[model samples]
Target: MKKITLLSLLAAFVISCADKSQAPGAAPVPLLPVATVTNENTITDSEYPASIQGKVDVEIRPQVSGNLDRVLVDEGAYVSKGQTLFKINERPFREQLNNALASLHGAEAALINAQLEVDKLTPLVQNKVVSDYQLKLAKSSYRIAASNIEQSKAMVASAKINLGYTNVTAPVSGYIGRLPKKQGSLVSASDMEPLTTLSDVHEVVAYFSLSETDFINFKSHYAGKTIGDKINHLPPVSLILADNNAYPQKGKIDMVDGQFDKTTGAITLRATFPNANGTLRSGNTGKIRLGINHDNAILVPQSATVEMQDKIFVFTLNKENKVSKMPITVIGKSGVNYLISEGVKSGDQIVLSGIDKLQEGQLIQPEKSAPKVAQIINKK
Candidate 1:
């Protein structure tokens, strides 16, 4: 209690001295640290959540119905194009092929018999031993037998194709994903679940979406008027892995979706990154970082600015050294500074400290100092 009273009396004595001094001249000036507005190139970064995938993501499905006899490739194995991955039971297919071959042989034999009959009737007709009508019947029979043989040949070809399908080969060069079906599992052509998945991860693509407003802003920041020029001139992007570690390799934005999705109101973009070490894979979640550079950008230390009722303000000293709070338009931020678009120009003097106690048009002592925003909390 005594300390509080003593402090209040000291404050009153200081106020009395200030009032007497002001009565003679003006008011007591508040000492403030100031920094000059700087203009330089600044880069702003934006991060969007992204999903990573390989260049080719394919579901391994069976083309023929059969019991899985062998799984040649283990899960997550690297496979070359046309490499055998699975083998289904070929016994059933081979039996069907034998049946088709037998039918085809029977038809061929019938065709031979019909041809003999036609030959016999042809000579008989010439000798007048059989009627010409009988010869015509024999010729028709021969044509029917030929048609039957052709039909049976088609069946044999189809069976052969099915038998070949028993050995499933990798259609592309990639790494195998999860193996859902085990050996001896009855897999069919119409099965709901795929046998496995294959992903070519040599180069991975990170897909991210941009909101319509963000997309427009991004396009406007580039140097070109056309979309192609903007894309071609775009800077490389970086990837943040799921664990928040930065990916070692940088990526380039090469593809954009045709249009915005109606339901999501966002446009998709793809960035390709090299996975030479085969670290990236399909279905990985990450973030994509995009950088935008601004030339001759005006930057203000955040400590020099004050926010009042959601508007940002900074105290500028006029020629008379009187401080006046002025509003500044903050377009973006880089580290500890706000990139002001308007309301503050280059070479303006801004107060860096004691902002909470400042009033508009207050006369004060201006001290030129280079105090960073991060160091303000440690100031005396």
Candidate 2:
């Protein structure tokens, strides 16, 4: 009787423990943060490769051909307008001027001799001591001498002008480029390469290209009947330097190409930026960031999305608190959030954290608080 009671008690204890272990709700659902999708207005940036150029880029070339006597400015030097940039050998030009002056003197002396002969012949012809033809010939000679003096004077003036060309001066105030021709090197007005280049960097222009489709989309986003009107209403843009840093100043779109390139089908556009500090230079490269605004756009945090086979998906919560993996159509990205066009709507809840561990049809206990979509959109 004692063994039977002990065995029955032990079996009862074992059954009690098994029943407790198999009770319903023994395992708790995972508690994950969830957020409701909302419609918000936001702006996204589009970057395009751009090439920088100064507002005034001019190639400095000689106006006359001669040996370079002196290079007044060094490479990368800043110069002012009317500053002498180079000096050519002036000996040849000086000699030419002297020759012209000597010719003028000779013509004047001839005029004096002709005038004397005409005076003597006119008196003799009046007295009938010689024929009138002698006086006429002497007058003609005097007239020819006077004409020669005028021609010689013109030659002297031209020589003076040519002499002035020997001193090359800057046409504008800017920084100088390379000095390809050294002292004593022969340079000409028709040389294929310029002596140097001057760039006015107080203002800079960035040139970038856009494809045909991009151009059409760009025009449709603005509220204007013409491109010029659209540009007037457009907001200022930013420049990203080669080092991936944003430029301190903002720029405005000022020009657009009239036609697209037939081979590349891309249209070029220009944006001007102020560089009062001389931070930017010609031949520098960067990217132009253009902002586009979207209204009533659906936004989702990137943390809640996952990529699989080149497609993005988010875990959405149903009425029963069950999570379903749904694909979203992402139009663009603003800051840490993506602008969604489809797959989720307002009032829809999505898993905000630990999305990697989530599986389809999984039950989750959503937290009461949600992320601020407006704050995220404005972070851009």
Q: Largest TM-score belongs to which candidate?
A: 2
lDDT at residue 267 of model 1 (Cα atoms) = 99
- Model 2 regions more than 4 Å off: 1-27, 105-150
In candidate 1, residue 246 scores what lDDT? 91
Spell out the clash pairs found in candidate 1: none
Question: Model 1: per-residue lDDT, tens digit, 1-380?
Answer: 99999999999999999898877655678778876675777777789999999999999999998899999999989999999999999999999999999999999999999999998889889999989999999889999999999999999999999999998999898999999899999999899999999998999999999999999988988988777788899988999998989999999998888999999999999999999789998989999999888888887777778898999999888888888989889988775778889887878878888988877777878775655333432241
Q: Whose lDDT is greatest here?
A: 2
List clash counts for every candidate, in order: 0, 0
What lDDT is obtained when candidate 1 is compared to the true structure? 0.88
TM value for model 2: 0.86
Q: What's the TM-score of every candidate structure?
A: 0.77, 0.86
Candidate 2 weakest lDDT stretch, 10 residues: 371-380
What lDDT score is found at residue 223 in candidate 1? 81
